[model samples]
Target: METTATIRGEIVTFLQNRSMTINQFARISGINSGTLSNILNGHRPMSMHQLDRITDGMGLEEGYFYDLYIPECIFHTTPDWRRLGPFLLRCAELGKLGCLHRAARMTLENISYAPMLFDMAEALFNEDKHEAAALLYESVAECEKFQYSERLALCQYRLFVIGLGENQDENLQAAVYFEPYIDRLDDMYQLDAYVKLINVNISLQRWDKIVALGKRMGHKAKIHYQQNRYRFRTYEYPRKSVIFYILYSYLIQASMHQEQGDYDNAFYYVSLYEHPDWINKPNEEELLIIEQFKDWAEANRYMYGLMSGQPNALNQYVDYVDSREDEIFLALCNIMIAANRYQLHIDHILDRYKEHLVFKTQQNQLGKISDLVTLNRYTRLLAELGIYYLNSKQFDRGLAYILDSLEYSIRTKSDNGMLRCMGIFEQFRHFSSEETQRRYTELIQDVQKLSVYAWSPQV
Candidate 1:
């Protein structure tokens, strides 16, 4: 066996096993990032100092370096993922959904241009959730709207997804493409069309139009009430869709203030939208988001501390947030997560956001409409617990969470949660009791089946 190869492999595996990146490790150990990478990859032999750095950084005794980095190729090079698992798991622990999503996305597509797109996506996603290439969504839309060229629709979708800059060449080009088809999309997707139009107006920096579309979409239910529904009536909407729209408007308003560097007012509006309104408090489906919110708030607080010259360490954010009252801290924590989810979604947390478990027995306990929101919240929590369990890969535990999500979905009038709730139930059906699996299969697309599961309006 190649002794050099074995030593290099061992060193790489050891460093990675500690969950430190080359950049992070290099910084910690007074080594150069590129040089460290080269050494780990076997291009450079370990210098005594470099070995010292690795060993010191790892908090291990001297032989640790030789143990890991000796013997020609005796170390089977760890698979790339074998090294990556630590980074990804660390990201998950930090509740850095963006980090986790970026890493997962990186691992997913092993194609040319994938790296560039993934890098750009990570930066954009971190700064703004709407930042995505959306090649997939655009392609799908083009196929759907073949009659009118899909370029504009695709552009509209992209602008909406990224949600920034009006005069930029790319954004303007997207706006130019979508401008022609603007008047034509009126009745097509109804409220969704209105939402898209508002998004397009935002790209063009036509705040007047953006505001007008918002008003119209807000009143759409009153103006366009269906035979109690739509052409896509099968698509259930959240009862709080208007509230959702309002929140979106305010977020954009907050972003505008933030851009102006008016931290006071920007944060004021952010707090307005972010405050835990009884009406808007997240139900159980969003518990991961809620938890992640705490993590990010802790992270942000830590970052702020570093900016203010505090020691650079993990619990930096947590320590700062703790200085604030627990209630204020929790509220801020929730806000961080909601701020991202408001525009687009990141994946690691998508399933957490989509937890679909229900408790038939507990749901039966919620017999009143007056209790709907509270009960829905409870059931949603149960669903999230399922999601938490499932994410842990405890198959049995996840199944139970899915059952709770389903019960909530069936009990609530919220069509918005359906996509999440139904989705989880569908996934769980295969693993659940045959009776639930059979019933859910029958109830699959039938919205009415939800009536029994949902709260009675009269109650």
Candidate 2:
């Protein structure tokens, strides 16, 4: 679209009318002398920042620029406000975002009615919109003032994205501008801001700075980032520069990719967000990434697990099931046994992942007996029951769990699983009386002497 060169140059003209010299004006207006000279001489860009500073340092209503030009050729002209909007909308539906953007930029540069100009810009935005959404977004800002600051700033922030291209730099500026209204902004928008800030700083290669900024931003930045750590393993960035894009680009990319079910890139970009730069920044949309990853992983694992069971890859799938199912089972056992829900947890273990339970039918668990699956579901249940007894202040019962878990863990050579048993062993000693602890400890060394396993059925 068109740059605001005329409006910017106008600011230089406004400054020139003042009696202050270049040095004096620079000092008073707090604008850079170099920039001011360029603006006055028509050699530089005029920015909204310049307009704002000029408005503040000088007594100009900012609307004065609008009034100076009688017809107000700032955004759109032709008084075709009504038709162009709908016409532009039609063009956009037919795939003409660029045309819409040009028309909108022209409107902003030509029209006196600021809202009309915004409409024209929005029109351009709506046309063949995806490529130029950011441009349209930036066009939302109007030179005219809105009475409510929050509404005005939000409008401006959106327009800033459109006009400037949604790159990190532009979004960062937008974020800072809307910062005062930050507390009142929605959580998703806040996350967008923090993500933009982090991304901009990273592109600038200011990681060291992000370390502190991340902490300062708090949960708005971190919750999703941290939770997705495990989920991102499947994602691959493939390159570096792909990490940073303007706000418009990021949104467009995210929206378009979502339709394709292509999550790797989205997750990768979010991983960049999870870095020291964005971690802990609290924002509402924060959960979107993690939730998305969880959904993806859950679906992927199930699909892969099913495929893994094919005769073509049964052994491989068995290995796959071995690696994951055991860990999940152990964690479940730990959580449920500690909570005294062993029976309920047992049903969960059996109903789900039953195919992965490779043991035979004779070992006793869940009201049945199983004989062959040596280190299978039955053994785990036994271990968990021991843990439940232990967790419930029953040292003898806890010792029984450790011993059962030990038997299974030993047969399986699951060192990790053994570590869990050792943990309970320590818990028993910590909670039990010294005399009882010593006896259980001795029993642990000689499991054959235990009375519970010495059961002789009287039929």
Candidate 3:
């Protein structure tokens, strides 16, 4: 039997076996008759104190009713967080995430408990219960609405970071969440917020916005550094160097152009980061990251040359990327290299990584937000496999894979993936039958509509 049902049944049986009328039991338990009657009839739920009174009145142990009632009330009751906070902390410590989530949901409207709730949420987040922590943080944010407090900004920042591994919708929501607080943020948080916003713009293919924001961030960081130079010299440089944000902004702009397949523009943005004076200012770790990004941009530039049929470019780039361990960029290099090798090589590579790719794709799809890079990777893989099949004259299989790729790309708002699939469809149009060509034409039209709608003012 269910725990609640068993408890309810046991309570009724205890009253019956004791030969107690409702009024007598109510008086003994110090509960009103109607409340007792309602509880017995299952028309209302019992509170913690009411259950305790019943247990005590029946000469049972002090905590017998508490054990039965708490689990039920944790989810259903309007929380008195003063009473519930300790219980929730215990639940989190004990790894009872289900109970923790229940308590968080119940406590959403407890505005007075926002500080304690934020603390608990932070604890949960630190414990890697991201979804539960996000729920609690959201509750705190809602309860503390219209306040320009640090706590509220922290909540939005947490949501933004968590949303990065989710989907486009989550990224968009995170962007919106941080919008109002951008100007009020401290220097560090302001830079972080702009970086996250740039990421969202990249996923949405908002190239103009990415460039504009990048410039704005750069200008702001420059002014901030100029204003704070005296303080930095006096205090021995406690915070992050202002040059870090400026370099990061340049890297984001470079990535924006790279995503749009504009290698010249991408290289120009990378050149901004490579300026000698700016390059010399970064600390060790920051310099290492910057070097990694520079290498990535150079590798992508090589890939573009190979894709454009430049002689020996594939072999040269493959040799350069062969010794690298960065998984995502390495995967991109390997995929392109395999395409250059042979159809069988491409098939073998796809087969090897197929399960991992599908699992990641499904996980992202099931999440509240999708991972932008993973979605792009999965979609590209499908398109590549489709192209290979088409080249091998497997018309039906190729069409199925390409169409599926387009659907997935559109669903996730992956502009890169959609564009890739469209290119494949156009390149292979002559190989498909007339009816299939018509279908491909319709799909292209739909993709166009989706692109328009995505950027539309009404949307």
| Best model per lDDT | 3
lDDT of 3 by residue, 115-182 (tens): 88899888888788777788778888787678878888778777767666434665667677676676
Write one digit per residue (lDDT tens) for candidate 2, span 222-252.
4534554344333322111111222223333
lDDT of 2 at 271: 38
- lDDT (0 to 1) per candidate: 0.47, 0.45, 0.66
TM-score ranking, high to low: 3, 2, 1
Ranking by lDDT: 3, 1, 2
Model 2: residue 409 alpha-carbon error in angstroms: 52
In model 1, which regions exceed 4 Å deviation?
1-383, 434-447, 450-459
Task: Give the local distance difference test score of model 2.
Answer: 0.45
Global Cα RMSD, each model: 27.2, 24.8, 9.2
Off by over 4 Å in 2: 1-80, 90-139, 142-148, 155-188, 219-459
TM-score of each: 0.25, 0.27, 0.60
Model 1 local distance difference test score: 0.47
TM-score, candidate number 2: 0.27
Better of 1 and 2 by TM-score: 2
